[model samples]
Target: MKKPVAGDSPASSLSPCEIPKSLLPIFLKHIAAFIDSLNVVVLARLLPQSHHRRILTASTSAVAASLLSQRQHRLVLAISTPLLQPPAASTRPLLPPDNGIKKNVQGPTFMRKIWARDKQEAIQVEFNDLGQPIDEKSSSELAHFLGAIARNGRYAPLHYKNWIKVPQTYKKEMLTQVQEKFQLPPGQEDWILKSITKKWRNWKSFVKTNYYDPNVSLVEQMKNVPERVHEDQWKELVTFWNSDASKRVSDRNKVSRGHQKMVHRKGKMSFARVAEKKKKELGYYPSRSTLFIECYSKGETPGNEVASQAMVQNRVCLKSINDPTQIVAKGIVRSIDPSTEVGGSRLRPNWCEVHIQVAVEWDEELIRRYGMFETIGDALGAHVAWPLFLVERDESDD
Candidate 1:
């Protein structure tokens, strides 16, 4: 006998019609039951009505008979329910239908283009051979130059671990670059250098605060280096930041900051801006005390006890100086220039003490010539004040 091949298996040889008569009904019933068990409603909802009808029409006679007998009610319900009910109202708002041609949308890119154009127009400046702008006094031009230097690899001051430790050559080079870009006055170079140093220190502090986590490993922290900083520099910084020395120094500085009593609420507004505003409002520049009160206090009272006490003392001193009984000789000198006096510039008007001898004879000629003072220290030049006590001592009776 020939060996049975793979396709000659008993099950594979049996066709649908070749199955035993008794089991044929059972097989068809099982197949029909399986079709009925399926989520036909979901399928009917997803498919078009024509396709759903075609599926039912294509079924074998035996299976169809079984389906009609067992699931006739279900088939009618599934098919009719979808047709009877309208589709759920879409929650989303209707957008304008898309055309074949794509239109250019005014999004971030368009806004960026507008901003770039505005910035270019706003910061227009003529550059010299050294690439410095002609308009040195223009703050916008100066800001542009500074921004360029910050991005340039040649300016190494910004990358230094410690600004104080940065070499003088690097600082001089940066100053020279700034000078070449703008015509800086003689003493203004120092101011520029100081400003740059402050910016660098602030940037480093920002990096330490945001990126340097004490709990994280140095290598891991270095991975999160700021885009402006070099990887090697950031690695070194992270290593240093992780050191005990850095932590100790940071803790000490934090403690020192905590001890500070009088903090200003002026925010980013500088004293110069405050003075300018006050000058505009009052028709003259405000005194340092007035500026202090404006910066550190709300209304007339100061924020802290120390500042409040100082303000009170200041008022008392001013009142006493203005009193006729406390008046002594005036116009003894043509003018008192605080800048010319030794350590005179350091004195504050409110802190000064004045000892008056009410019993002693006043200088009649001096008092008559000067007349009553309009304001305390008004006789003195602008920004000048008597910060010391004037005690009258008589040598005739002694």
Candidate 2:
């Protein structure tokens, strides 16, 4: 009898009893499947009558060798193939039906925290405020926003022609004009680059080696040399005009030249320019004609009380000359002598002045029958108040 190798013994073969005595009760005394294999080795040396001895001896040797070789091959395959495969997972599923019952239930509620009902409530309140009320603003404020032109018409309009200097924004566009106007000779780009490179090449290497050397301080000395050639995959342009880096100081000359003669295309207004020229030639600017008028209304003219009431009503939108905080008509308007000098300066009248005596809230205006230009305040200081009246003619005036 030949001894079986490790698992190839009778234990791997079918036994008389498949159901063990200990497992018989749980398995209900049933028979389980059995493993059975055949191993045969036969050799017979009969008479040399039919050459049976020679054939059987050769066949036996061949079969035994083949079986041993097959076993060795199987062993090698099982050992070597495992080395080629990936490592087994750390944790394996339980056998049979254990996997069906296993599950992990504890995990963070990441999405639920961000999308809570409280967040939706906050957004609802925010959207409700879109229907809030707005207060009504004053019309005078709107007038100021529209570039209100005072009714006095004392000054001229601010047109482009009045400009004498260039605005800052237009200066940036002047560079294009310079390139079109000043073209270099043929191969100038190559020439300029080569010339600059040759002159500064040695200086570049020197700076790289002794960058902090007190002798070479200028950035110009550190640029465009052998070391600054940027062979590595790093920034090569530490200078201006190199890699959009700030060359503001070094490009000063080039940029200044580019902006040469750069100015706003504001043409001089012929009338305004000529006005000053004429003034210079005549030794002085021209002045407006003096307005001398005496108001003398008669025949069923309004009484002092009614006239004063109308005058106050006309100046309802008026502001105080001395202090804007104190209102005019609302404060008080009492009758005073036309020649009365309050604080040494006589009160003057404008074209709107009427001959009436009554009071509203502020200053008293004693109506004057006659008025002169010289009685007004300082003309240079712009304190002289006057109405730019458009006279309405009545039949009686002719």
> What's the lDDT for all of these models?
0.47, 0.27
Clash pairs for candidate 1? 132-181
Name the top lDDT candidate.
Answer: 1
Predicted candidate 1 versus true structure: per-residue lDDT over 122-223, tens digit per residue = 433443333333343464446545544543435754445576788888878877766655544455665566656665666577666655678877656766
Q: Pick the candidate with the highest TM-score.
A: 1
Q: What is the TM-score of each candidate against the true structure?
A: 0.42, 0.14
Q: Stretches of candidate 2 above 4 Å error?
A: 1-169, 172-271, 277-283, 286-398
What are the per-model numbers of colliding residue pairs? 1, 10
